[model samples]
Target chain A: MFGKGRFVGIISSIIAVVVAILVGMVFALISGGNIIDTFKAIYMGSFGTQMGLASTINNAVPLIFTGLAVALPFRAGLFNIGGAGQMYMGAIGAVLIGLYVNLPSVIEIPLAVALGALFGMMWGILPGYLKAKFGVHEVINTIMMNYISIYFVRYLVSNGPLNGVMGTARTVVIHKSAFFPILWNYPIKPVSISIVVAVILCAFYYWLLESTKIGFEIKAVGYNPKAAEYSGISVNKNIITAMALGGIAAGLAGACFTLGEMHFVSNDFPVEMAFTGIAVSLLGRNNPYGVIPAAFLFAALQASNLQLQLFAHVPKDVVNIIQGVVIMFVALDRLITYLLTRRKGGAKGIGNT
Target chain B: MEILNTTLLNQTIVAATPLILASLGGLYSERTGVVNIGLEGMMLAGAFFAVWGDYITGSPWVGVLFAVGIGMGLGLIHAVLTVTFKSDHIISGTAINIFSLGLTGYLLLVLFHTHGSTREPVTQLPYINFTALERIPVVGKFINEVFFNHTPIAYIALGLVILTWFLIYKTPLGLHMRAVGEYPEAADNMGINVNRIKYFGVIMSGALAGMAGAQLSIGVLTQFVQGMSSGRGFIALAAMIFGKWKPFGAMWASLLFGFGTALASNLQGTNVAIPNQFFLMVPFILTMVVLAGIVGKSIPPAADGKPYEKENK
Candidate 1:
């Protein structure tokens, strides 16, 4: 597993991340911020206290789900930019079910989750079907779908039947039984059991991609769809399945956000999570196991953002810049490794002549 | 009957200007086989710089130049990654989008000491009022309402569309770009510098997209709001595809989207029974339907998104 190429990949990723952070620090300095204070604020805000740790884990839950959403489609050579839309649809579904359904905790919770996943699956499959049948590019279709879903949900909460009585563009609070229970309450606003679900899903994703036949086909398709088609794999089926699975993950993220953390769906719910998932998935190299750590790192950064803004005088938007730079560096991973290898007297470069 | 009012037509023209500019920019790069998903980011950078330049220099034209320069800089970065380093085009473009989003927002806070938007308006781009043309016969009313009495950039955008059409179909340079896009190996065999053409195409896209951003900031709004480009970049991409990658086709498609936007805004004020959100979704839905090939098949260039490689001598 630790071959020369894998080792090089790991090293280059580390270098990329470190370089990005340093670049962010330089920007902070230019913006009249003290680098040491900013770093400290970020560190303390994420993991320094029990409250900070809980917030970090809470923030990480949705990221892991969205990361898997991007990763699964990536495994099948699909971009799946519809995670935001899928998540929004999933949230709407969950909110509707959570608001109306009256059942025992055991039944209602699972039902809402399933509905969320199903709604997201439907949204995901539309683009997949379009791509499979009409050769429509998923990137454009997914983006369009995102705007449609966002606006649709906005309409649902703002003016539709589910609109709250408080004059806010939100749904009513979910039933208590439907809420995700606090797995561990260390005095920090009750850490939800959703994190445990996220972990299990991550494990299941790893198993699916590693052991299952469908997973093998998805990976094969991702590697080379033409080759996979020649080898008897149904590339189209894999594309649909991969996207549907990704949608399921994103849908679950929405469900967790509504049922576990926020307990309500609002029009202004953070849609940036879907975009951040792209950064996390790329940083994790799209590996399910790798996403856990990557999600944690990003979650920590996010958890610290407010503190960074308050104490270090750095705007939260700087984190976006850092994430962007990290992604750019990740895209140039091969070049970085090539330079490193060339300096080490290995004449052969990685990828493209 | 008022739905077809001159005000709506004027609004449509205003909305279409940026889409035409950005789509045409996308057309140039895509013609040379480079998929530019970063047009949105380039536009955002342009919007930010346009406002910033106007704020500092007190000249909207200078701000437009600043936006174009910054846009070219971003395009150079994209070209280096996609053309020279042979990075994945989509990933590089996505990075550009994300980078610009973060960089612009961060700068907004640092420079303006505000978040979400720069509330202060910069000098607006000057509108060209043709008084003589407005006094002409019946045609003058149509011309004055639809085309005249607008910022000079709008006229430039319309002219650029025609220029782009002529350049791509009539000129030797256009033929070489098409050759590079359609068959890089063939172009390479004929001694055409594939990388140079790709670079020029992408850089030119950046410049055009930058000007589009300037049009948005100075011509339309006169202030830079975070994510002010909104989905216009993506819409422009759709317009490019809907137009079948032709300059005139993209202009028509852009005009259609602009009409959709204008209609949506118009409906929001009237007693339209449907939710305004649905109106906001019309352009995106239309884009998806177009991409689904329901209207017609919109195929991209054969070599589009593929990196060119030179053979060893």
Candidate 2:
């Protein structure tokens, strides 16, 4: 049986998602599109065939990592909005190693991935250090870092030594030895082994958070820094550790994207995947286990959005509207709970409501 | 030499107009203790609506009004979520930003049948030439060149800087708003309507940000591009913080950033070895340095980012 508190959270999340979809449907109707066809397009785009499903899962791969990146820091009462920047740094680090290091597949792939994680960890730790040492707010710092990382990467690829020889604002194609092998032989898109890595990482994240003393310290600090300090925990240390862990996940996401799909780094590469992770973490309630399904849902929507646009003549921007509304509703979870409880003649002593 | 200085000064003022307006907007919200991170989204909404209004009505002034109205509507949503529901300000802000981007993009496709940007040119806001001033000597030349020949919003932005300083420091309503930000319970005890003051502060921010957006679309570019606000709203937030949440201080900070932007564009024209992107990074890097308190301790409001509840009292 589900705990009453968890049951309420799950029910509210479900309602929020359904409400968002309905809102999207209304938008479709106004645009003179058939609502049923739009819905059908979304379903067909995400799950109509094995290839569609594979692509949907492939899209989820980055979301899962970015979700973990956000969720881990949230557990320590920190918002890691710099995931985009950290992911970029990770990608650049991986690309540098992938293009330069001419080694065996086993050594090169793991090294590139580790370097990516290390770079991401560096980005995450800077803000954490600033917050711990100077009382600087991480939100502003992380946002600032995001722009810095973006511009820096652009400069490197566009005009610096990393520029490709082919007159494009991108690095040279990464070595084939660094490529992640195909896990499944799907006709349309080969499912990269990065999906397996992501699942393993998710399992590790769950184990680390649920069964470790550091995890307890992180949650305790997140709950109340003052109380955690009184209990002899180093709040600063936990903050740094949690941020580094989050960065590591984000960095791995960058590596996965580079080695598994992109195969090279370019200036025009999309960084919005990191932003979608915010929605994912929110929908997941910042829980490691919850992030999987949350990421999957978001990924499916993203994968299907194009099909909806092409087949149903619905604007793909509707997906953005749905995602935005879902986050808004989730943020207003207290209001939803109040309305629901009031309608039910009051539920007594529901936690955090 | 005089021509270069005049051009630089002109560019600086033109660039600073939006920043000053947006920062002043941020100042009001922060002064009333609401962290308005959604200024970016609100400004984007304003920019889009300004173009839409201009495109439909064929008048820039009407477009500016539309932008302000839409911006305030977004502000109202933020007020309800944060003030009424007692939601986290940051979460509400992030949601508002995400919502604005999506909603604006959706509206653009529906109304204009365009992607990425509106193709139609909006009616540009008129400028004051001050031709009489140009006929005078050195002083008049300075005045004509530096203080005139820009959109009316630039003048309005300058005037608002002084007005904001006076209002926040001298007015009774401003006192109540500041008191609410510092300590809502204390303001409540003093018979101030805390919620009303906060709402007004946030809504005023939205209006100003909307104007800033209008300045960008109709006043500067005469067309609305997707994500046209760029990171100016965020830069304004940094200016607000760099100014230590003071109106005059924020204006000066805005000017500094405006100067940085002007310098960046100017340098890009020169044979500088550094890439254009590095110059673009200057504002963001400076923001980080300022936030790190190397410039000074840029402390925020006392009760900032906290949701007030009557039961807690």
Which ten-residue region of model 2 chain B has the weakest summed lDDT? Answer: B1-10
Best by lDDT: 1
TM-score of each: 0.96, 0.96
Docking class of 2: medium
Regions more than 4 Å wrong, model 2:
A339-353, B1-4, B294-296
Scored by TM-score, the top model is: 1
Candidate 2 TM-score over all chains jointly: 0.96
Off by over 4 Å in 1: A1-4, A186-188, A340-353, B294-296, B311-313
The sequence of per-residue lDDT tens digits that candidate 2 reaches over residues B123-191 is 899987988987788788888888898999998888898999889889999899889999999999999
TM-score of chain A of each: 0.95, 0.94
In the range A120-233, model 2's lDDT, one tens digit per residue, is 999999999888887777777888888899999998898888998656789989999999888887876778998888888889988888899988998888888889999999
Write the residue-wise lDDT of candidate 1 on A113-133 in tens digits.
999999989999999888888
Candidate 2 chain A: 10-residue stretch with minimal lDDT: A344-353
Tell me model 2's lDDT, rounded to 2 decimals: 0.86
lDDT of 1 by residue, B1-313 (tens): 3688888899899999999999999999999999999999999999999999999999999999999999999999999988887777877888899989999999999889898889888999998877788678877887778777689998899999999999999998999999999999999999899999999999999999999999999999879999999888999998998899999999999999999899888988888788899999988888888767642477788899987767432
